[model samples]
Target: MAGFDIGEKWPFALAAILMGATFFIHLVAGGRQAVRPLLADSGTVPLDARMTLYYAWHVVSIWLAFATLIFFLAAFRPEFEAIAWANGVMAAAFGILAVVVTVLKRLPAAMLPQWVLFLPVAGLAIWGAIR
Candidate 1:
């Protein structure tokens, strides 16, 4: 906590909090709402497909957790800024993809509101990086 100056790097701190919250929501709520159902489909969904999707889900979980830690570290250590930028770009990409998919698939925006969660985290990370 010695070099953790929230006043100077509040954006990164805020980004970390948001990312952390998002990670937990994805892990817990998504597991219950999405993964559980996917796993429960014994006959309809193929085992290989289900397992592949499950692997991808955990990959995302790991990425979110890593980014959260990197953002927290970047809030205190200037050296981690590059990593923050990388994570920010990835976050922005995720947000943009959500919007693109919603529009292209003719799905309701509210149905795939990932952009609402990710874009702000991207914005905060970029803001903190350049601050």
Candidate 2:
């Protein structure tokens, strides 16, 4: 918030880019290794790009999104003047698109954490609208 303009093009875009980069990294990293925290022991099957793509792009994209929320809350919280209809549109778009696509696809329930479906993208939307 000190030097950032949350509602402005530069700071918001920078944050979004950082979020995107984080998502991409998680996708390529095959969150399986990353997800090991939840597993009982090591030894897991190798996954191809498709696996990487889903976990990384599909899953990590949603998971790391919280960072984007936090970044905005910390960086752009001061920019209330910037929070407007455009930001609202972005929030709705992102939250809806991701959740809708995943649900409509009927993605296999087994491959994901049970609560993964309930992640609060609405929080991101709220953060976006606030900033």
Candidate 3:
């Protein structure tokens, strides 16, 4: 990885921050500022099984965002090519997690998670961009 740019992966962290900020903005604009509903449940599905699946999705996304943070570090910190390897693995992990959650809960592969989940995803994406 000679000649690899340290700045290549920077800006991820900024993307993450923007994501979290966007959620707050949307929540305030929508006039639904309750923490419990935003965080715990959204009342979208009726079945307990569905709810569990839904929550599982949220949990995975949360973790993915955290992993994305690590990748972002590579960009900002400019580690060796090993950072690329770590980020690549994280990317695969996110994909697998997303697919598994979608299939287990009978959710469409392209489906969007509830608002709560968006915040973290946005945060991760933004963080990636800024880092």
Candidate 4:
């Protein structure tokens, strides 16, 4: 944490930006993708809004948690590196889980990019936290 607050520590800032971007893209785009099909035939049939809502909540909750870790890393406000490490581990775990869930849910191919993008974000966050 010696250079945590300095501009010289670009990695932490980059990791935060990447992770935040990942969360933003996934939250907005993924939500649209999940909800589209449900709303497609809403006029003709009883759309299962529950499924779309479920995905939205799940993605938001997970990515937001991960985003918090990235933000913490960027801000470098933690008094203890251990706390950052803990959040980093959680972020990485959820990053992996996001990929798995994306495939398991059989979502559109477009949604896969965000999960794939998250891998690097997760790696950077962990690296920043530990380094």
Q: Name the candidate that leads on TM-score.
A: 1
Stretches of candidate 1 above 4 Å error?
1-4
C-alpha RMSD of candidate 2: 9.1
| Candidate 2 pairs with clashing backbones | 27-56
Worst lDDT window (10 residues) for model 2?
113-122
Write the candidate numbers in order of decreasing TM-score: 1, 4, 3, 2
Which candidate model has the greater lDDT, 1 or 4? 1
Could you give candidate 4's per-residue lDDT for residues 12-68 as a string of tens digits?
Answer: 566667766766765677568765555565555444565667666686658566665
Worst 10 residues of 3 by lDDT: 29-38
lDDT of 2 by residue, 15-38 (tens): 555555655655555456555442
RMSD of each: 2.0, 9.1, 8.1, 4.5
Quality of model 4 by C-alpha lDDT? 0.61
Model 3's alpha-carbon lDDT is 0.49
Selected candidate, larger lDDT, 1 vs 3: 1
Is candidate 1 or 3 superior in TM-score? 1
Q: How far out, in Å, is residue 20 in model 2?
A: 7.3
- Alpha-carbon TM-score of each model against the true structure: 0.93, 0.31, 0.35, 0.59
Cα shift from native, residue 32, model 3 (Å): 8.1
* Candidate with better TM-score, 1 vs 2: 1
Lowest summed lDDT across 10 adjacent residues in model 1 is found at: 1-10
Model 4 lDDT at residue 12: 58
